[model samples]
Target: MDKQPLLRNLETNQPCQPLSPQLLSMAATAAYPGAPQAEELASAPPAHLFDNVTGYEGTTAGGEERFVPPPLSTAEGAGRHEPHPQGAWSIPSITEETAREAFIEYASSKCCYSAKPAKEMVFRDLKSCNTYRYRLESFTESRSTEWTSEPYKGQFVDSSAYGPAPLPWSIIVEIPQLFQDNIEKVPVPHTSSIKGCHSCMAMGRRACTNCTATGRVKCQFCNGRGYKFDDRCNRCHGIGLQCCIQCNGSGTIPCETCDQSGQLMIYIQLTVKWKNNVLESVADQQSGLSADLYEKMIGQNIFTDEQVRVSPIVTFPEIQINQASRKAIQEHQVQLTRTSLVIQQRQTIEFIPITQVYYEWKGKEYNYFVCGVDNKVHAPDYPAKCCCTILCAVPGDLPMASGGQTVPPANMLDKLAGYESIAADGEERYLPPPVYPAYNAEGGQPQSNQQWSIPSISEDTARQALIQYASEHVTYSSRPAEEMVFKELKPYNMYRYRLQSFTESRSPEWKSEPYVGQVIDSSGFGIPPPPWEVPVDIPKMFEKNKKKVQVPNTASVKGCHKCMAMGKIPCNDCLQTGRVKCRMCDGRGSMLGNDTRCNHCMGNGVESCRSCSGHGQQKCDVCQGRGQLYFYIQLTVKWENNKFEQVIEQQCEFPTQKLSKVTGKELFSDQQFQVYPILGFPDPRINQISQQGIQEHWTQFGKTSRIIQQRHTVEIIPVTEVQFQWKNKEHSYFVYGTENKVYAPEYPGKKCMIL
Candidate 1:
């Protein structure tokens, strides 16, 4: 016997080594300050002394202008244009307090065009006379602004960052860690159900109409069947009677009530509906409508309070007539008539006066100006003027004149002496009415028939149709008659009469024989057999198989051997308890005296069941090991063309004092600003566009100045110094101080210098 060779395999495992301290420190240093440190000195070479190429000296060999430049920075050229001057004082950066004061001052200033109140004249047209009266009104002031100094009002505040100062660096660590631990696990949802069912036609056992829907029928042989019953008949054998031929089996005839169809005709109500309700108040407005009628039809009472008043201006009432009739006209009466009538009406229009007077609402002063009305007149006799004035016309006749000389009477011969008539033949004869010839009774002659001949049917078609028809109708007994007739009636060939046939008999020419087969084989030439075959049976085959499969056991997998090497066996952690705890009663012993579960197997008893984990089944930690956890996010977007529009109107209520209580100084400028009227530069365009200036008043303002000129100047401050001072200090400065320039003085080295 040969000695068996021994084989053994040994395996050793080791863990990865950590990096050295020096290399780790060097990597940490390189990553310090992130991208910012690299960017600052990015274009310069490393600062190590060995990398320097140039020698050190007090100055570069090429001097100041030739020195090389370092890389550009983000802040380099930002304020290149604004340079500080050598001696001027510089403004310090703004502080929050100073900004607040400036903003407060801005908020207190008033607009320049505020209006003031004043007393003004209004004219009214009365029944008999025109009246003029004065009333209070508002007008715009030349300089209406009011201003006060205060603190800043325009600044934005953020509320989210208002907490105590933070150690800004710590946010980088805490935010991500907090979010990662709190993530929620979401579950998967069930999907919609899908299923299908087969379709089939309806069928059932047929019912016998003779017995109606009831299965039993009367026995005809037994008649009323009080006692002695007859045996069921075999073709009525041994029975007294059989089923009637007319009624088909049972004794009763077809129902005379429903005819044969077994259906009845009767009237039935189809549908009913209620009418709409009418309130009593509404019915009162429409007097012809009755609320009681509506209540009866609608089955409910309606309550209403307000009476709606409808205007005749918008809706008119229907017209009424007393009577109407139509009749044949046998006679008529005619008459001529005349009448005189007069009508009068009053007309009014919006009236704007030629001269308008104005006064201050809280002051004694008043002012006046004019805007003329426009009018037109087509009749040359009436003069066109403003409608503000009244025009009265006097009714009087013109004086009848013994004013001019009279002429002589007319002589008839002078009017008619030269007139002559050209045609003396009784007046011109009228032309005869145009004649239209009558239609001829025969219309037109018929055309000759010699043009084209009609086609004739083939002899084969005629004979074939006759043969088919005779075959269908003739019985077997009639065949002999048909054969005799057909043989006698069949068409024959004709030949011209001649005596030469005797020579053919003596020496005959060759002749051909005809085909004898009754059936035709025309398939190759494409004419199909006259009667085609109908397909009868279609065959189908199917095979269905069902089977079960088995998997073979193979090699054993490697277990957690590291735990085994420590002198302690590897525990089955899947059981969730150490020592695989007794698998029955889940490690609890049997109650009373016996093991409630198998003693050798522990509480689980068996193994690997999906539930009970088979020693059987335990919780799977992988799905916690149950299954996978899914994540989902629900998004809701309310869309309208992806855009929404809203129209908003904002309103605010403010305190207002009565005009009567406001003082004159609050309404208009103080008397000190008032002055005597004076002439100012004239606006030629105003004069040119005026209607009166274009017509009668052109010479009053200017002659040669069609005044196409377009500008004018109105000085708010008068010639008096008191008025100028009262208006404002700025106004005073403009009128009294010497002129000064606002720009800075120039210097040699700098581009701009302010003084």
Candidate 2:
């Protein structure tokens, strides 16, 4: 039975296509030795699954028009002799002076390192190794398929209404342009059908696995005991049982397979993905430098070629370059062609120069490498490290005495005597002498004449604020504000500007559900209007809203898949038995170890299933007991108002976030479809912010979402810093915004205990 053709050409009555190379190889390996039979090749999966169609058009099994990708073209002048241009192949080395400066800068950047080595080291030798890098990029497209289903709403069944279903590989789908990374999913034409939901076996609900169809479980809170610690259990009210939460005491849950519609719309989904694959190979330089370092360096591009399929270079001076090119091309084709179709191929060769400088310092040899067009240096080891201590002395200090005997000050003599004794006795008794600057008796005074436009609150209002703050924090006391002194208040004004861009965007998707009673819109049957072209009422600007509208003419009705047109299905809870074990007695016909008859079951071992009410069947939920569904495409329109704000930095020590919470005085306001930046504002920073906000909003959201309206406003938030003296100590508090909110980080009353 397996050795038979799954499909045949309608005209010739022969096999539709030949077996793939992979399938043929598998058959060759599985065939018996000396056997001449061709049955093994025919036993493989259908040829369409792996067909390599090399055409732009084809016909589906149902004679419907389909799209087929064309084969890749060969690169022009491939595998031909290409002469190198004069002076383009030369590798230049950097001068010694340039190498020294780069090394000196490198040494100076390290901590506790001296530049003596860089200055004194003599150049011994310099080696230059030029390496070549080969890179290949293949842009390809691949396809995959999967079976998906939705609730069987009254949707048009394409296969039932049209002709036979098309093969998966033969379905027509519009492919996006090649060499770009993209993903698309297309439904196979004439493949959609209605089928019974296999999940619940056409049942609208499934047995509650949590309670095992008993509708009740042992009470978790009371541990199945009627009483708890000599008292009746409150959770179960002495019944020692609780209704199943999953089934809501019905012993069954709505079937998820059919979405409670009791049917599904089954179809094959084809996913086409376009991807760019990159592969690189570098020629072995043997320069003792890491290949990864050369990769970061930009090399001279001696050769570049791009085409549908690139051939390996055969006439290059470097044998390694020719070999690497051949290997890369073969590997790319072998790896990508098995699962995907190559649309284009690009290959290039780069020649990077590397210089290794050998130098001598302090009778030892040291080496450093310079790489790339930017002359990046890599030096891990450098000689001449210093750990010298710096000392600061007062002016006009005593000079060193004759014979290197230094004359110390009287205070220094005491510190030195203790230092020597501690060192001789290994004791930590010595202390470093402290250096102090000459103290000035006169100190700066606080500014007293500054006045605030926004005055401080009255004593009564401050008291109420203290009480309100105390009520929120259990540990805080309200007694401090009553006695604290009022000090000077200075206001610092902060400016803020906010810009809002309100945009509306629409996205469309296919949706289906069990067909109930719904108005059918056949006007939108053909190609629906583009999202931007569709006319929709724009709501008030800056207010977010979302609405879904069905596309006209896209709706169709199909039979229910889950219940198979049967309005009802067997109840999963009872499994068509219409009965379940009694929960009170655990199917023992009695309670308390079979000593007493169970009151709930009247001595019966089983009770009727609550899910179907003893009928042993349930109404299909997917089709809503109608066993049909309606399918259509829907457009979701979403409105979003994006907000951008900028606040000028204030010189004072006020928190910027605090200003945002309070109301401010609006200085300037503008609203339009596309508002221009403010030209003449009192604060130059506000004008700059306005321009930046508008430009940034347009760049970030203009492409993906449609802009409906733009509005910008500037506000001045007044902030005051108040300084007061309390118990000979200075304290400060801030008052900001039009609301007069206070920010007192160091309130003097907070440090005092009221108790």
Candidate number of the best lDDT: 2
Give the true-structure RMSD of model 2.
40.4
Candidate 2 wrong stretches, greater than 4 Å: 1-92, 96-125, 152-157, 164-181, 359-365, 380-755
In candidate 1, which residue ranges exceed 4 Å CA deviation?
1-584, 592-640, 648-755
Measured by TM-score, the strongest candidate is 2
Write candidate 2's Cα lDDT for 38-94 as tens digits: 322232222232222222113232212233333343543346344232233445568
- C-alpha lDDT (0 to 100) for residue 563 of candidate 1: 22
| Backbone clash count for every predicted candidate, in the order shown | 39, 31
Q: Give the TM-score of candidate 1.
A: 0.09
Please write out the lDDT profile of model 1 over residues 159-272, one tens digit for every residue: 113433222111112112210122221111111111110000001121223443233334343442322333344433433333434344532344332233322221111111
RMSD of candidate 1 to the true fold?
Answer: 62.2
Using all chains and alpha carbons, the TM-scores for the candidates as numbered come to: 0.09, 0.38
At residue 682, candidate 1 shows an lDDT of 36
lDDT of 2 at 276: 82
The C-alpha RMSD in Å for every predicted model, in order, reads 62.2, 40.4
